[model samples]
Target: MVDQVTSILKEYSVHTDNKMNEIVESRKRVGHLYDMMKYHLGWMDENFNLSRASGGKQLRSTMCLLSCEAISGDFNKALPAAAGLELIHNFSLIHDDIEDGDEKRRHRDTLWKVWGVPQAINTGDAMDVIANIAILSLEDTVKPKVLVSIMKVFNDMVIRLCEGQYLDMDFQTREEVTVDEYIEMISGKTAALIEASTGIGAMIATEDADIIDRFKTFGFKIGIAFQIQDDILGIWGDPATTGKSAKNDIRNKKKSLPVLYAMQTSAEKEELKNLYRKETLTEDDISRIYDILTAAGSLEYTQSMANRYKDEAMSRLEGLYPGSEPMKKLHEIGKFLVERDY
Candidate 1:
């Protein structure tokens, strides 16, 4: 599945390159600031030396480009929008890591950890400005009306992303977070940008409201499912491959779907609550939490929900493109995200 996603992304390597090049060029006046952003993007080292590591999955950008290509004949025209979406995603990640007190991302120290919180906050703020600029760059490639529509959608997504993040932070202390509430939080926090990506892609490629609506639905469902999959991985994934500690979320006592499910259904709810209230968790606590999660069928329930969303995303794509390669690739990507191990 990793290779499959890599193959699909290969078709749009230039878009990624152009996006990075633009980011680099956009920061010529502030070399230090650029270095901070570059390091966070996995493009350079702390000393400003270039690195060969690929930045990220670039999943949202790929979906945007794919939606454009599926509707029209090319995705290059939507490069700026794709870049903007990627920037927004990374911006949120920078803030999220700070909020969560995470130390690592992609196997390296997070920006706030390496550069201090104030600088990291400023860098994230700058990235938000640059992301808006990137979207406006679409003015050169798309019609004025289309650019206006895309910007409006992008703005709404940004607001929803903030609301989702707030809900997520609030959930950390709120013991009564239900499954439905978790869904709403993730829909805003994780899925809103993806929804914008595909929607803007289709909007750029065509003017058909129905098609754009379908694409938005596709992105939203898959985005939610992908987060649920990550929650499952957070508890049970192989730390070696996942670049995270086993039961990472358990140690943090995050209100992920699996934990919430266990809280609701496990016979050990009182024990789980008592454990979660501690300031620190030992490996023994994590293991016991895992046992409680498993005994409550949390893992199975989360997987079932992921599958349900992926299935619905695929269903929405049906007849939208018939047998086109882009449509097929979108379906494949949705499946891969939900089913991937690492």
Candidate 2:
């Protein structure tokens, strides 16, 4: 799947390069800022070195093309939007890592880790600008009205992402967290952009409001399932397959789903409460905590929730009648995300 997506992106390099080159003329004075962004993007290093595969999965771009195909539209016409979605996703990641004080992503040092926080922040800001500007490329292919819809979806996605980030940070301080808030927070932080990517793809394909609505719903459910699975892996997954420490989230003091569940459980709630207030939870503490969380069925509960969302999403997609090959790919992708070991 990765290779296939890689090929599609390689085949569409003109769109990527054309748009990036176009940004140069309008973005002078901040030229070094753009250079930093490019380095982070894997185009060149800080010392002006070129490399390959520096960026991650480009999932948003895949969603864009898939959404178009599901609607029986030529994905070729949607290249600009495809690139725009990918750019937006990457822009978010660059900012998200800094905001979370995360030092690693894609098994490498984060942009902020390599550069200072201020430069990384500005670099991320430039990427955000580029993402918005890239979306405007749809102007030539679609009507002004449709363009407005595209921008609306993309803008709302960016705003909701911020709101979700705020919720995640806030959750850290509060002892109490509802399941509803977790769902809503992941929906914004992780799912919003994906939902927009697919929904915008639908927009590029047709004018059917009901179809677009369903796609938006589909994207949200997929995003939720995707995030839940990530939470699951963050705790129980093998470091090699998952590309992260087995207890990374636990070590970082993250209030993930399982941790919250354990805290709220009947059997092991007090056990969780006893250790959670420590200045720094030791490895023994983490082990004991993991035991309590598992005993409380937090792991089971999280997996079940992710499966429920996956089933719901697939159910909706099945109801949508027109199951094109691209739609099948979307279904398969969702299954892969939910069922993946890493």
Candidate 3:
């Protein structure tokens, strides 16, 4: 189903791919640094060998181009922005893997693990700079005034993304993180980028702020729902499919939505709390936490919240581009985000 939704993006793949390659190749003076970026992007390996390391689903870039097409805009004109959004998304992921001490991504060693943290941080920063450069290239494709406005939106989103990451790391140390706080954190950490992708797409495609706002709203709501489902997958998804243990997030003591909900509503809150405080959790302790989470109905609660957000996203999409093929594609993507199990 997601493949169906993403098929609309097939048209823009070459454009975005070319832009990504160009961005990485632009800094030939820092060849080694760009090699790291390419490695992380799965274009090459740590030894610069050609291998098929998955570079993720490129969801942000697809949404950007789709949002542009939804407004009857030429997706080719939006290619730079699409590439920019993907770069920013990957930039965040590179840093996030470091912050989370994640050793692997896509079943390969993370950039930070392969390169030291300092070098990995440099590569992430380079990706961000490349992202900004990519967005600025839109000046040739869009009106100068419009490009400036889009840059403002892009810059503002960068700050929010960092703030959200800050809050996420902060939650790990604090004993309590309310559901509301978790929502706010994810709004910045995850949803903001998605919103920017859709919002920038609409911004480039049309001059109507109203339509742009609608796209932003649609992306934001669906992004929240997407992240919530990811949280669920972090806990209960099959490791074979997800490529990580179901208990991975729990072992890291991530304050995911389900855990927060369970902490607030579970009768065994104290036990769960004590379990979290421990430096290490035994297998039995992980099972107990799962039991408590289930007993508290946390999974259902999280899914209900995700469904509510998806409903809102669909409503916004309807208003944004009624009965259009692009709208249908966007709607299907939203459904896939919520419905994907792995």
Candidate 4:
């Protein structure tokens, strides 16, 4: 399934990348500002030399284009939206790294770490504007009414994404966070854009409100599952595969699902709370926390939750283009999101 999804992504990624590059490169040069954006996109090195590097999996954009292709039998009409979604996702990542104090991404120095926070913030803002511009390009391809609808969805997604980020950061300072609160945070922070991606794609392909709603729900459910998988990987993923240290989430004192569940149900809740209150944690502290979470079955609980969402997401696709290859690929992508090691 992984290989199948990889092949599907490879088929679409080239066109998506080309669209993004065209949008980025067509801009007026402004004294290394664009260079920073390019660097962050893995198109150039810090020295400003062109280089081929992994930007990311392009999951959101691929989903968007795939959704369109699944219904319309073509993805070209969705290219602008795909490019816009990818740029929006990356723009959020730049700001998120600064806010979270994460110095590394994909094994490279983060944008803020490499170029300083002020410029990085400016660069992120520029990328966001560029994303908006990319979406506006849809005016040439889609009807004005359709263009307006896509813009509404895109702007609403941006608002929800910001709200989610706020809740996530706010959770960092609070002593306690409920599972429902965590779900709300991730719904905005991680899932809103994904929902918009598929929803917008379906809009481009057809005017069937029911079909669009199904795709939106599918994206939303899978998006939630995706974040759960991410939280799992943050705590237990291999450093080599994830490009971060062991138990990096613990090192950063993140209140992810596992920690929250253990805090609520673990026999050693008091000790765990005390450990989390410390200004800093040692290797021993991290090890003990790991044991507590494991003993409390937090990992199993988290995985079960992820599977529940994944199953719900799959249900949205039943009977929709029953034998379409793109639909099958979308299913594979959903499984990959929950099962991927990194």
Q: lDDT of all the models against the reference?
A: 0.88, 0.79, 0.88, 0.93
Shift of residue 97 alpha carbon in model 3, Å: 1.9
Top lDDT prediction, candidate number: 4
TM-score for each predicted model, relative to the true structure: 0.95, 0.91, 0.95, 0.96
Candidate 3: C-alpha lDDT:
0.88
Local accuracy of candidate 3 as per-residue lDDT tens digits, 114-231: 9899999999999999999999999898999999999999998999999999999998889999999999999999999999999999998888878888899988999999999999
Per-candidate clashes, comma-separated: 0, 0, 0, 0
After superposition, the stretches of candidate 2 with alpha carbons farther than 4 Å from their true spots are 1-30, 319-323
Candidate 4, pairs of clashing residues? none
Candidate 1 achieves a global lDDT of: 0.88
Q: What is the lDDT of residue 300 in candidate 2?
A: 90
RMSD of each candidate relative to the true structure = 1.6, 2.5, 1.6, 1.3
| Residue 209 shift from truth in candidate 4, angstroms | 0.7
**N/CA/C clash count, model 4:** 0
Worst ten-residue run, lDDT, model 2? 5-14
**Candidate 4 local lDDT, 243-323, one digit each (tens):** 778999998899999999998899999999899999999999999999999999999999999999999998998899989
Give the Å error, residue 335, model 4.
0.8
Report lDDT (Cα) of residue 128, candidate 1.
89
Report the poorest 10 consecutive residues by lDDT, candidate 4: 1-10
Write candidate 2's Cα lDDT for 30-96 as tens digits.
5477777777766766675765545665666777777887785577767777767777777888988
Off by over 4 Å in 4: none
